[model samples]
Target: MLFPVALLGVVLAAVAHEGHVHDATPDTVPETEFQSWVAKYGKQEDLPFSGPLSFSHLPYAKCLEEPDAKFSVAVLGMPFDTTTSYRPGARFGPFGIRAGSRRQRPGRGYVLHYGFNPYVSGKTILDCGDVPISPVHNGLALDQMEVAYADLLRRPIANEEIDRTRSLALDGVEHPRIVTLGGDHTIVLPILRALHGIYGPVTVIHFDAHLDTWPAPPGIPAPYEAAEITHGTFFTSAYKEGLLTNSSIHAGIRCKFTGMEDLEHDVEMGFALITTDDIDDVGVEGIIKKIRDRVGSGPVYLSLDIDVLDPAFAPATGTPEAGGYTTREVKRILRGLIGLNFVGFDIVEVAPAYDTNAETTATVAADIVHEFISMLLFEPKEKTAESDFRVQAGRNGDEL
Candidate 1:
């Protein structure tokens, strides 16, 4: 009788547990409710902090890998810094700049100054990813950059509505413009070589604390030919190769020099100087006049070294100078040159290992790149082959 009573109690407890489990399970939603749930949460937006990394969260494509890919502008990275003279970590600059652009997105890409969103300007823009660079060999890395840049430069433009009159296409066929995230200042030498192939010599507007035109010293000899291609001497090499025109100019220059002969040689290599002190003397408008008057309307390439900013504003560059232009001044100057035909652009020498907790250096670099995108997509209402009213209009209070 006792065993039978214990069995009956166990059965009752098992039935009670099963009943509780059945009551706790949720019922499936009706078909209409299921569709509403899918509509709310099916697709994920490209949020700043949650999506795959790309510049401003633009679409990513391997331009080198896909021959048929179409884009009007591309952001290419050259992660080669084997030729840097001082710092060793600028090879990581491309990744740092991308990370610093986390707060920017295509939906919020409106520029208050320019009053347009480049992402929606009827142009296909892509982050074409980085060129594969050899870390151990400088010669191979330089060749890799040159070949990669030339290939990308020759790709057909995706937009049929591109105004050819405002562009630098020597042939009637439209070509894509590239903004390179650099490895070091030395990367410009190969880039100039590639541009020379298509556009002949181009006018360069160099913004740097250093002249970057130094040649090998009179007595010393390089152990190898590639050893002569340091970041400090690339402009001289470009000059030797005839990759520059006489209209090129330099701004924010305040680097230490051996003598006045450095300025003389810089002039011979086709550059006029605007020192950091000149900003205080001539003011921002005066500097804008100087750059616009010098570059005129031509195929121009702009190269900006991160050291052009005061170390207070940007301290993570490979070389830092004490006094330089403020970030606002640089942006103003860039805005003032809106009508010039820009064929290419670059910002280099950001060494993230030396950056601050706020990542000021890389963030500034990314902002300047944002400015580049706006500058490219801008179209003037009244543009002519002989006159640059667009630039004069920007200098005044007119929208571009």
Candidate 2:
């Protein structure tokens, strides 16, 4: 009786196996609904640590790859620091800045002072990724940057609401504004070359601890053509190339100069100096007024070297000075220049290897970029006059 029971169990197991194999055939299974699966999993918000890394979690677009891709403003990275005078790791500045910006999501990007969210202000802003730069050759890398920037500058505007009347282009055609994350200060020379092709010579607002307009030092021998266009002397090259307007201004300058002759050369190259000590005497408001008065309503290209901040505030830079603006002072000055006609901007010299674990330098650089987006999207004052607290208080018969 035990043998007969074992045979019966084996026969039942064989039958079940045959049935399972038949049911598991490819044609017998239902196709998966990808749309349903995507609907369930794809719409979630990106946590700061989880998403594909981009500046402030903004959309990533290969603007260079897609010719039809349009944006009002773009965050472009130039990751070549071969021309750096001191630190070398600024080649990674773009990556450090994007990593530092992880906490700034588009949903929470509202500025209380400006009373609007730049991320959601109906303008298409994109992280266009980094320019492909050749590390082995400086000349090749610079030329590549120039070509890439010119292509991006010529792309069609995504926001149709932008006022073409305010454009500084001689043709009055609207062009996209670019906020570049720099390789080093040398990148600005190529950038100015690109901008000159469109708007002609633009007034530059340079924020740096150094004059940057230094000619090759007196002792540096002749026939050193390659040494002439370093990070320190890019502005000198720009002036020679006729890429700058004579009204350019330099703020936060306190770098040790060769002599009064350096100041005379800087002035000759088209820059009015505003020292770091000016903040103590004339105040932040005074600095802003001076910059505004100098640049006026002309097309302005703003360049900020990370060394403009004191080493205590932003130590992850190539060349740092003791007395420089704090992050707060820089932000206030940027806010005060909201209505200026800015065509381009850059934050340079962020060498993250020199930074602390807190990433203070990259973080502050990213926040300043947030201010750039706000300034670019800011509506004309006349349109927002109704929302002014002063006007609202008057209407309600309120007193301070």
Candidate 3:
């Protein structure tokens, strides 16, 4: 069992370079009124984000507020997508997620059933933007994936980046929860390796339609390897490298269209899959409970492929399988993970180009991050819900 929670003791000076969108002070409200407002709202967003402002940590931009060291969660965006078989635009995922989140109305930004804003709770999170990637031709993109892998694998270990991620879990700073938004599932390999080194044997709760654990097809030519290294075979690499724990669960797999031989091969790999049929049988809440128990006590790492949602719910992803978890079902499952020793979480494969209305997946994706941030940041209070509701309703009064 991992320590209830731990943060690498290094002070997060890196994120100090990143900038924050909101600078509204707690003192904006008078003390008496502020206390009354807190009593009324518990902890909820005054408005759902619907604006046109956001911040990022990409090489193009500067830094943001780094808070007073201790934090609970950190978000990193790996925007290299040389591995997707079909759509190749996911390399821009980090920008889209951050842009979506920045547009969110800060402060209880995701105030659904529970008050949420993963970041605003004074949690130290760095939008450590895209990992520096090489500019390769799209046709040869998949072939050059090895370059990104090499960069990710050897990022000057024991360096400042490690110190930043390590300190996120420390007391008085942030909760040290990591939520990575991706270039492809392969991006998880390096991240998991780093995390496993920090906390051994972490659970990888993956939600995707395809069993991503296929062996890297040999030789970099077309035909068999035609799909570029692809989003198709990330897990295969991790599982083979012994980087991922065998106990990790692969949920939301609805892939029966492929040849039975491939299916049998995946089955032999010891992945306990929760197919669409299983999700239907157990109910999302029930399945969530099952996940909580299986990955119990230990530090858990979660990776959600937006395609986990049915194509109807998220048409903007690189790979859109027909039937999958409904939007509501996905929320139920994510919401249930509260209070667990979740080390970090990631949401990948969101390609806005595939969207008819950009809001389809981007909005949902943003809301998911917003909600997760809210859950991890807020200390559970007895009156949290009631207070959040009243305060939200009284925003005009509360803000005044």
Candidate 4:
């Protein structure tokens, strides 16, 4: 295949500069990296964006194919939405979210109000690119996703001085965390499985419009059967596999159930529900406290279903519901979660096919991810004593 000269030049520029040292005198012979870059590539507009598809256009964002290197966190894309019960194009969520995040590149300052920059917080962040999925087979797709996440978890965490006093590090070595751009809520099942393999059963902090803990559809001979792998039933599968703790809680729920028994069943599976209506009664602070109280000091996994926001604010999701929280409300709530023992996170159900000119849903998805990264860097408003939480780091110093 013949390549365009501009594209070829950009590719060659990237390939040629991997380990070359630049001379510093700009006027003399293009010594420094920027000068050498300009001399070699001609101009900024001449080269294509470097690095794998990444959020925030971070320079450190690297492809997973590179020899293993230390990174505090990695953003992995799970572009598999075959199991969605409603709309299907969430398969493009990672792409849409990445495009939306590019809008932040010029500023690269996501948390303006707090003045926190995750990229410069002594933590290396990588965009590990998207996991390949078997489009025709949902079961195989999920299996592939689980294996991908597992492989990522095995890599070394970037070397950083962890604040044992406020960091999520329960052991001496902090395992790199993953911030997953989800294909759909079903993606959580595989992610949870990989996380469970590393951290044991984690307490869940689920934010969604639906309970997602519905009993697996009938006629599946046994629990967690492949036929039962729809988005709505994965939590049940997670529960069956002992991947979650009774301390788990679901916020922003508004989906109607067949009967009260469904809620009872969810409780039995060890999850508490904080309906969207409860947000008004308890207030955001109260809701935050409830979440913290429920999750306590256990290792926690956060799953954010964009549909948890009212369709008015985020209509691009697959299963949007009315009467859900506003974008601002959700942001504040997530910001409140900063000091918890978060192990991993996902923002799912962003089907940009349904979005308006505003790119409302994709932008919101990016912002949610931004907050997750913020949580990784910001000190909790109040740091608890190191002895308060129970954290056992795995043998490799990269697993929890």
lDDT of 1 by residue, 1-400 (tens): 9999999999999999999998885788556886788788894567778788888899998889999988888999988788888877888888888988888888888876666688899899999999999999999999999999999988888886554433455665677889999889999999999998888899999999999998854554556777888899999999999999999999999999999999999999999999999999899989989998898777899999999999999999888999999999999988877767788889999889999999999899999999888887777555654345345435444433
- Segments of candidate 1 deviating more than 4 angstroms: 1-38, 41-44, 161-168, 217-223, 381-400
User: What would the per-residue lDDT of candidate 4 be over residues 6-108, giving only the tens digit for each residue?
Assistant: 8899888886785354533456543798878888888652122444456777554344566565577788888888888878889999998987786665235
> What's the candidate order when arranged by decreasing TM-score?
1, 2, 4, 3
lDDT of 2 by residue, 175-255 (tens): 989999988899999999999988999999999999998886556576556667889999999999999999999999999
Q: For residue 28, what is the lDDT in candidate 2?
A: 48
Ranking of all candidate structures by their lDDT, best first: 2, 1, 4, 3
How close is every model to the real structure, measured as TM-score? 0.86, 0.86, 0.67, 0.81
| Candidate 4 Cα errors over 4 Å, as ranges | 1-53, 60-62, 110-112, 161-172, 221-224, 380-400
* Per-residue lDDT of model 3, residues 1-400, tens digit only: 2443333322343344333424435556656887788889885532334332342221121112222323234455667676677787777776777766645544325454554444454545444334555546433443343343333322322213221223423232222455667776666766665655556556678889878877566676664443434467766656665666656777898875458767766655546667876876788766876776666455567888888999888888887889888888888677666655566677889887776655678777876776666545544434344224223322323333
Looking at candidate 4, the ten consecutive residues that score lowest on lDDT are 387-396
Candidate with the greatest TM-score versus the true structure = 1
lDDT of 3 at 325: 84
Candidate 3, TM-score vs. the true structure? 0.67
